[model samples]
Target: MEAEIITIGDELLIGQTVDTNSAYLGQKLGSIGISVSRKTAIRDNESAILQAIAESQSRCNILIITGGLGPTKDDITKKTLCKYFNCGMRRDLTVIDHLEKIFAERGRQLLETNLVQADLPETCITLQNNVGTAPGMWFDQNNKILISLPGVPVEVYHLIEESILPKLQETLQLPIVEHRTLVTLQKAESLLSKDLEEFENTLPKSLSLAYLPNFNMVKLRLSQKANVASDLIIDEYFDKLIATIHDDVFCLGDKDPATHLSEHLIREGITFTTAESCTGGFIANRLMQTPGISSVFPGSIVCYSNDVKISELGVDPNIIETYGAVSEPCALAMANGVREKFNTQLSIATTGIAGPDGGTKEKPVGLVYIAVSTESQSICKKFRLFGNREQIIQRSSNAAIWMAKQVLTIPL
Candidate 1:
């Protein structure tokens, strides 16, 4: 099966609101073995909505429309849908009763505008909204399905789960769909794609690969939707794909870098700490983002100033005066100090000049020295990055985290 998503909103078109509904719907439809062919975001105009509906109906078996459903002047989706379906608007008593109960329980007064939300297209079946006043609409016409949902994400989720999904299961024939994602860092998209070209081309017809890149990492997702049992075949391809990119693979699954690091540390029974300068505890925060990390992560010290480096992290003042704060020696000293202070086997330290200023002939902006130290081994590397203040800090933080992971993988 194939589907298309039409997000109707002037706010979304003008960048005032983000249309997360399209992605959510597309993923949901995919899980039901319905592949989304296209996604369109249009303004809250009657002509635009009509055009989208006509265009999408011609090509897709299922068309999902969201937004423009509100008890306000600008909300005209229901009225437009009524016109398109050659029907009139009618008040739904079931919706009105649901809303009345909600308002009474909340101790709020209902206005005429609120009552207007009960109006829906006569030709479409009303799907009950459990959490909100606006009811979802489902129309099956000419062997095609069209579903209209409210713009609020939580309300949309509620209606989709409680009312829409069951009806879809009854109306459409779907196949089994599954997905597997692997996270890899320190590899560019171009390089990864080039390495996986042969592997992707050799995959079975039911499987597809997706490259989802982030600021410092890439997520390689493999999806399969078919009637035949392809689980073993899919796993085999996944193993091959990971083997092809073995050098760059960090962890297998949808978990982020922080979660993967936390699980790895927990499994290895290792404790860790952080000492930061320009990154200002960003690495520490990322490490602690995963739950149950408090037992392994002792603490972090942010020595942003030269005085703090000397007094807090116990960096030698003479070293800072001789080679500057953002130097390899300073970074090593910070890492060793934190690891010894916490008595942990692993520690990550960052010292960088992340700025649009504070550069010179010898030391330029975005000059960073990251150090990852263990009880037996410690290493430090200097980087010359190029970005503004925030980007520099972020890059430095990512580098430090990656360095720590790389250290653990090394065979001492």
Candidate 2:
């Protein structure tokens, strides 16, 4: 089954808000053999919403809409849906009771607008929202399933997880769709593809290979529908492909780098820290984003200047004088110092000239030194990258993280 996602809000068009709902819905729908054909974002205008619904209803079996379902004046999706279905509004007693209980629990006075949330389209089934007050609506109109969910990401997640997904699974006959992804780092896309030319050629006609590149990693995704192909055949091909390119693979799966690193660190039971210079805590931020990282991660020292490096991270003044702050010595020193200071099992460091300016012939812009230190040994690498200041910082941060992963994950 194919579907269309419509995200309604003026904020999304003006860049004030990002339409993350579309991605979430698309992924969820796709997992149930419902692929997203197109995504449209529009202003919260009645005529536009009607037009969008009319245009989309005939094209796909399932249609998802997020946003503009609130108690405020700007929220008009409920009314719009009623008009499109040529129905009237009816207040749901269950929803009103839920709202009253919620208000009382919070010790807040309920407004008329809050009660208005219980008013849904007359002919649709209501999907209760456990996370928020706004309930979701599921309309089986004219042979198509149209689901209208709340704009808030958390509420949307709850409605889908607790209500909509199971309902869809029970009601619709869905095919088995599988996607297998693995990540490889350090190698450029061109080099990696050339190396995997034979493996790609050997892939079965039922399995399609897609290359998704990010900051410093290439993700290889293999997709196949079960009806068109056998699972055993897909597995055989996937194993062969992984075995062929296992030399370049870091972590197998579609997890973010931070998540992959966290799993490894947790499994290895190694404590880690970082000392950042040009990236200014970008690597640290990424690491901290993982839950339960505090057990493995100590902290980060962001020394953007030679003085801070000397004062905080204990970088040798002579090393800076002899080889400059963006040198391998400085990078190694920072890693070693942070490791010793935190008494960690591992540490990563980055020292780079992320510059639109302040570069010499000896050291041009985008010159970076990365170091990953363990209790017993340390490894350092120098890199010459290209991009603007933000990109340089991002690339440097990603490289530093990968270096840490490579060092800490050595065969035992």
- Best-fitting candidate, measured by TM-score? 2
C-alpha TM-score for every candidate? 0.88, 0.94
* Per-residue lDDT of model 1, residues 286-396, tens digit only: 878877788788788988888888887788889989888889999999999889988999999998888788888788898889999999999999887767888888777
List model 2 lDDT by residue over 322-344, tens digit each.
99998999999999999999999
Backbone clashes in each candidate structure, one number apiece?
Answer: 0, 0
Taking every candidate in turn, the Cα RMSD to the unseen true structure, in Å, is: 3.1, 2.1
- Candidate lDDT (C-alpha), each: 0.86, 0.87
Q: Give me the candidate number with maximum lDDT.
A: 2
- C-alpha lDDT of residue 400 in model 1: 75
In model 2, the clashing pairs are: none
Q: What is the lDDT of residue 94 in candidate 2?
A: 93
Where model 1 places Cα greater than 4 Å from the true spot, the runs are: 104-107, 230-232, 266-269, 341-345, 384-391, 409-412
